[model samples]
Target: MAGQQVYLDHNATGPMHPEVVAAVLPYIQGGFGNPSAPYAIGQENHRAVDRAREQVAGLVGATAGDVVFTGGGTEANNLAISGAFLGRSEPMRRHLVLSAIEHPSVRETCAWLEAVHGAEVTVVGVGCDGRVRLDELAAALRPDTLLVTVMHANNETGVLQPVAEIGQLLRDRGVRFHVDGVQAAGRIPVDVAAIGCQSYSLSAHKFGGLKGTGALILRDPSGVMPILQGGHQERGWRAGTENVPGIVSMGAAADVARRDLSANMAHGLALRVIFDNLSARIPQCWRNGHAGLRLPNTTSLCCYHADAMSVVLALSSVGISVGTGSACASHSQEPSHVLLAMGLDEQAAFCTIRISTGPENTVEEARWAADQIAQAVERVRLVTAPEDIGGCGEDCPCFAHSSR
Candidate 1:
């Protein structure tokens, strides 16, 4: 934050929380022991793992027995969807269901299953408002539908899905439910028991914890299988050497997030308001997500004729950290899949850029970021698509194709 460069890309990956760093330091320095060993040091490591499990469970209104740790949200998601299908009996339903706005982990896995494992998958579409409609899913459901994996919130938009209704409908239908709570678990409260979902996925880094640590929370199902084949770990639900330090950091991060959630939410909301007001000052700027119903710290904005890649570079050059839709989509020339799913044309999606705030960012930084963005957009618009420049005089496309 030395210059004008302040990171506003919390959704992509957050700076590790201080509490999380404190929690993992001992493990990194000297507490390096295998939790599976019988020695005292091993016991200390195992105890740390247990404590982290309890903390994670407590944060999400779950019991310690319900949590199974994994490498990250992607692993948690794969294990939840693929493992559930594999755990079921032969003649298990052949098809799967999920929302179109789901993260790549969910969507792409389903695609793999269909292509390789003989599972048929259907994606329920979202409305322009960015929320999945329950009726569409209900219509897609069949006796052969083995599972439904819907994200609890859209990562790009931060719009919460109608989980309660989804739960109610799936009740007693023989179809399992898995919610991707990665983007929502710490940013918002999620009660798996309340939602009646069989499985929920979450990652620590999305909520200020270290990367490479995620959890798959499962209800007391009659059976669930491990996707990975390895030595006894994660109750045989996932097998590998435990990520002890990362788990400890995740637990500490969860503790802090739970205790300070209200305050964080309020602060983020205030900062978002300021960002929104600033965005409104520029002509032709449009917010990508549901304006009022979104994560407190995120804003994905679209400006006419503005290429997201160029806007990100221009901002970075001036010391404002942000993300174009580019990195999120693997630097592809394509627009946002989330935006397209919500009915935006490719043009609007391509023009989108996201700014997400976090605990470390200050209101002052948010203000400066907004001003920088407004100015950057005016310049980016001229370079990327001169035909779309309406508010300001046009002349600079030098940074239009720069790396984000």
Candidate 2:
């Protein structure tokens, strides 16, 4: 077991960047003042928030006014979905469409709306390649469809969705579109206008900022209602006192991500290539998702006849951190819904693990991590009996539907 620790789960969350930490130090130390206060210190903090807004907007090709800071990505998603549906004047437009592979934040929010608010929800399926089926999405639309929400990039498989095409399709149909850009914002070049989404969601933690801060970029704030009602903060779009230090940290992280976008992407691509080549040597170990149309930093590997959780534990024992699926649903015993939506059987879904690199990772680390993963999978397969190594227990819902 290596003494040194390697973190390859950037999709779940990442350590704060040094620049981000530096940017927030003053606010945390003594620069604390309520942005709403009518004093000099308050005005200063207010301006800081405005500057942070502009910085985040610059990275996503949005205006400062379009950025509304929220508690996190999940809150941003809730605001986008629930706000849009609840804010509309016409109750007839109650139909909502979503991609089957969206993060739990998006999926669960939509489900809540259907259950509690009488909204009609339609989930469009994905192909074996892990990309959403555009034709199926089009077929699922209706005259009463209020919105279509899809992720810009998938968290589990790292597959890039056809957001531009979907945007155009929804535009032609006169329907609103929302993009969950949580995993895409800092990793890829994003232009909300170019993508034609009415709203977009991103979490700062995914890109090296603090976990409690995120933002929603709204093309027109008037189109959605405020989910949190109170004093006029965030231009009355979001309520409650501003998180000064966290927002400032997000701004600094955004600036660093924008400046090093090209170089960081190249570095990640190099590391992915190295890791993929090395891991391919393992028997029956195949990479999931579209090879050419996925995030450069993410790799989803499925090892046949190996329990994914066992592999995760083995890797952890060796001072390596990875994920079986979304960290949000880490406690769930079910197999990955994203993989199942992409046509993987329950057994295959249970055998998958996700490895997402970050700016701090290096080519040498990628190679070593892949070697460790291969050894871990081998050990897991050797210990578990063949019949006992398959999908979840019979009590699991997926077990009933599984062909295995």
Candidate 3:
């Protein structure tokens, strides 16, 4: 392994920005007063938290009063789905709509609702390009549908959904909409008003802030009920004492991300160009998402005949970090559900890996990482038996060639 590591898994988590770290250090060290207390020190912390709310709101084009801080993105998503459902009346809350490629947080929460609360779930499928089929989504909606939740960008394939259009459709139908913006918030321009979603969720760690902190932006705070009932924190939307330091860090990160959004996007595009050029040289290796309709920083590549796990391990041995899918489900031995929904078979899905870049990643690092990936895939393919080389069956060119 090399002494210097090249990180390409920004979708899972990004390194904290120096400014964010500096911003949070004071809160961690001496700004320890509880925001709920009546003392002067407590008032100061409360003011700081309020400022952070505005900063986070600015990143998503939302009002400060609409932002509700939570423990993390998972909790934010849980609050968005479960809280909205629980707040609704009987028949209205009976049905829910979701995309096929949502993060496990949204998927599992809906599953729980179906099992426990008897909510009917309609999971709309995606096209081969990993984009949700709008017609299918429209068809899935019913009078009993309470809410439709979809992610702005897929965590595994990075494909951007037709959120604005979906929002318009839901608006015309008088149905509520929620968007999981965890992977899209810092990477792209996000206007909640433009999206027309009633609620949106984002995580700090996916950008350049500390982990264990996130926020849910609500267009109408009264539309959803609180899952955690205790303090009057977050305007009665969420309970428990505030995470002052983490919230401060998120504010700092959001400010920087908004300021450098264009520059960061350009940097990501440059890295992707390098990766695409190099990876194109590898045999039977293809991108998994829409070529132009995905996040600038994310690349999902499938190297046929190379086991994704083996490739990931080989790249790790060389100090290049990547991921097979969402970090939340990394421990699962199952193939990527995102790819499968996009029409990839299990074997093709198992041979896929994700590379998501960040502002800190340089063009030189991207070149080195792409080269390492190609070499790693080659190494894995060399060891794979002919029988295991083709997942496309008898008509597959690779399968026919290997048989001879």
Compared with the true structure, what per-residue lDDT tens digits does model 3 show for residues 201-292?
99999999999999999886555789998889988887899999989888999999999999999899999877766557898988888999
For all candidates, the clash counts are 2, 0, 0
* Pairs that collide, model 1: 4-319, 5-319
lDDT, model 2, position 296: 88
Q: For residues 1-404, what per-residue lDDT tens digits would candidate 1 score against the true structure?
A: 34655888888888888878988999999999999999999999999999999999998899999999999999999998888777778566778999989988999999988988889889999888788978899999988998999988787877888887898899998788999999888887779888889999989998878899999998855446788996888778878999998899889999989998999999999888877785578888888767777889888788768877778878888778787653457345556788898888777887788778898888888887888889888888767754442222234344344356
The 10 consecutive residues of candidate 1 with the worst lDDT sum are: 389-398
Q: Model 1 compared with the native: what TM-score?
A: 0.93
Pairs clashing in candidate 2?
Answer: none
lDDT for each of the candidates? 0.84, 0.90, 0.89
User: Given candidate 3, what's the lDDT at residue 397?
Assistant: 56
How far out, in Å, is residue 349 in model 1?
0.7
- Candidate 3's clash total is 0
Q: Each model's TM-score?
A: 0.93, 0.96, 0.94
The best candidate by lDDT is 2
